[model samples]
Target chain A: MMRNMQRPMDAMGRDELRLWIQQLQFTMRDLALYLDTHPEDANAHRCYLDALQRWKQALAAYKERFGIQFQEQVCDHTDWSAWVSTPWPWEKGEN
Target chain B: MWQYQKALQYPVKIKQPNAKLAKMVITQLGGPDGELGASMRYLNQRYTMPLRELSGLLTDIGTEELSHMEIVSALVYQLTKGLTPEQLEAQGFAPYFVDHTTGIYPVAASGVPFSAEVFQSTGDAIADLHEDLGAEQKARKTYDNILRLADDPDVRDVIRFLRAREIVHYQRFGEGMRLLQDKLAASSPWPKNPYAFNPSFDHECWKHKGRKEK
Candidate 1:
């Protein structure tokens, strides 16, 4: 389950890469709810940690390729236009 | 304290723009049992929870509902994108289009604006958790109604995801209720009368310091 993080980012298309990140996020979120009630479940805790690590890596790679998703991610030299110029999520073909 | 994540929790890539469908789907974003109410109900109710675990559960579920709100907004936005005034009117979206003009507004399908009156934060542990459980089922039923009417696969796919989440949340809230009940039972003078006092307001039950006995 963890090996996907080792796969080369370039191997997947933009949409595929985004989908991968979304899947990792879903895993983390679902695990989070389970852990909230069953905080003593060690197996779920491990899975949450694994998902968190993969989600972070995949998100970083996505930002590097597709520009920043959040304003704080703006680089010192990078213009703010880069953030506004990208298509909003609701726009067709942007997701 | 929350930072924005400029992405949908789930991907919504609706290919067709249908004003008619947008009208109905917008309800989940603003209707009485909508995502907006779901988020507010849990977040507001968390403050007075007697158990730490219950508070944590409310916070998590509340945050997820915010994400769900974004998803529903994206669906409405995508559905209404690029629709002409004539097209909108033909599809009975004119009432919304007149006031908001394709801009997303929180309103029921009947064009009633969103209101806080839809939910409650009674500050009682058992009551609030029961409300949450019912709220989840109501939201789930709304999604089911949407699925029954929605013909577009793209729209139904996203609706199904949101509906499934409601069921999961319902299950979690039920567990949270059990947790609260167990704590109350342990501390109650009479286990059968746990409802005799609100655990949230009766801080003495939990033995918090800095309070003078009356």
Candidate 2:
């Protein structure tokens, strides 16, 4: 089940997209921590894979609409410094 | 060898500047048992961990500590962003203000600079794992104290998230120690005392001359 119920990223504002992405990213991080200790847990593994796929989708949409989030996300010369030019996470008032 | 994540492990957005609160929160950045020491201790000790799983735990936990460090620093930055000299003096932040001028610096709540003397890396898996467990508790207590003093709901929310992480880390470290104990008990020459030798450094005795040398 897709965890995010927000409107499509294309229709959402910058802050809304960022917030949705943050939620999906957190789900992946939490699952990653669980799988580290219980690698053989089938249910947890399935949850992790599902979360991972959703996280990637949200992240791709975010970068496509706004800018790169991780350094490795940069794909072309036009995408250079996408990580740096993007707003720092701690910055308030805007995403 | 670690990659930087452009975002915080969680969000920290403090709308109102509160130098008084920032002064207390900054301790977690550089104080004894702070995230800086926590990260350094685990990452350094992992180099000598006997088991691959133990080392993996250290790597992941240590990396998480780095992210926590950033969150703490961001909290301090947001809290102290725009304070006048008068407000700083009134809030008892003049001392920190005179030195850093709203810039974030790592120092204990009592103003002691961060020191390697605060943490240990004995290179023994059991010892190191025990230390990691203790470190997590100390961190948790600090967050608890912060939660008690924090008035802003937003600040409290972030503090709660960080505090929960410490408990989780404590659980993971405890499991790592248990794994080490089981392996030692089953494989050690001195089966009775699971810690007969330091597994990370004891190469000769570790060959486990199965029947005992007696």
Candidate 3:
């Protein structure tokens, strides 16, 4: 009998990892906007920090496993042109 | 300074080309309450915003509107990706096709080009925030109208997402208004008409020190 268990991030496919990173990023952005207005809300601040940390970790994992998605992560000065040469997010369904 | 991130905020993989739907959806690109106008309004208003928080709010939301503008353009591009001259002419898209030929030009359904006259930047936080709140609703209503005419599930999914964002923006602007009111009520040298004094210009009204206004 096989059970449908959730796979860990390291074992996840590229698409799954991308989706996870996107979710965490969006959570952080939404909470950032909320905290901008309601600065005194401690609960929201905590939630934002948690989301931000997760986003950073997931983004790092994606960078290490796959190619760099964000340009800020690209630290190698010799291969600076790769950032421009790589397929953009809008260029969907391309090789 | 803004950086160009080459991606849609949400993916719009349009599988079908429907010219009729494209005309209606183009309104959100350049209509009176369109994304272009929305972005310009908030970004321009922020310079005179009384509080740093409110300025940041305008900046972030305005930036998001620029992203929405790209989304609208993507929708228009995908919906009119390929078609014969006859098909375009028959589907009430001849006028637009003659002018732009599938190029994403910001224009309303009525074919009027985008103009700066659509939005206002009053420099008064109260007035500007109210306008923003109203603008969000107008954009949401336009999306609702598009949803009524749209048949494709893919198109509806993207439109639904955009509409939800309008509601979220409206909520934030409302909170901004409440913050302004509370600050006004608690501050010194209070005007007979609290709404009369422009918080952006009047230094006294901006006196919320030590993290507490009261």
Cα lDDT computed for each candidate against the true fold? 0.85, 0.81, 0.80
Give TM-score values for chain A, per-prediction. 0.75, 0.73, 0.78
TM-score for all models, in order of appearance: 0.91, 0.90, 0.88
- Docking class for model 1 is medium
Backbone clash total, candidate 2: 0
- Give Cα distance to truth, residue B84, candidate 1, Å: 1.2
User: Where is the poorest 10-residue window by lDDT in model 1 chain B?
Assistant: B205-214
Best by lDDT: 1
Please identify which of the two predictions, 2 or 3, would achieve the higher DockQ against the true structure. Answer: 2
Q: Any runs in candidate 1 off by more than 4 Å, and if so which?
A: A1-8, A64-66, A70-81, B204-214
Question: Which residue runs does candidate 2 get wrong by more than 4 Å?
Answer: A1-13, B204-214
What tens digits encode model 2's per-residue C-alpha lDDT throughout A21-46?
76766776666666666667899888
Clashing pairs in 3: none
Q: Model 1: per-residue lDDT, tens digit, A1-95?
A: 66745467778767888778778877888888888899999999999888888777777777788766645456655636777677777676675
- After superposition, the stretches of candidate 3 with alpha carbons farther than 4 Å from their true spots are A1-7, A77-80, A92-95, B204-214
Range of the 10 consecutive residues with the lowest summed lDDT in candidate 1 chain A: A70-79
Two-way lDDT contest, 1 vs 2, winner: 1
Best by TM-score: 1
lDDT of 3 at B77: 81
Classified by CAPRI criteria, candidate 3 counts as acceptable
Candidate 2's residue-wise lDDT over B1-214, tens digit each? 8777677878887889888998899899999989999999999999998888888888888888998999999898888777788997888798888888888889998888889988999988888888899999999999999988889987898899999999999998887888777767666777778686788898643556344333
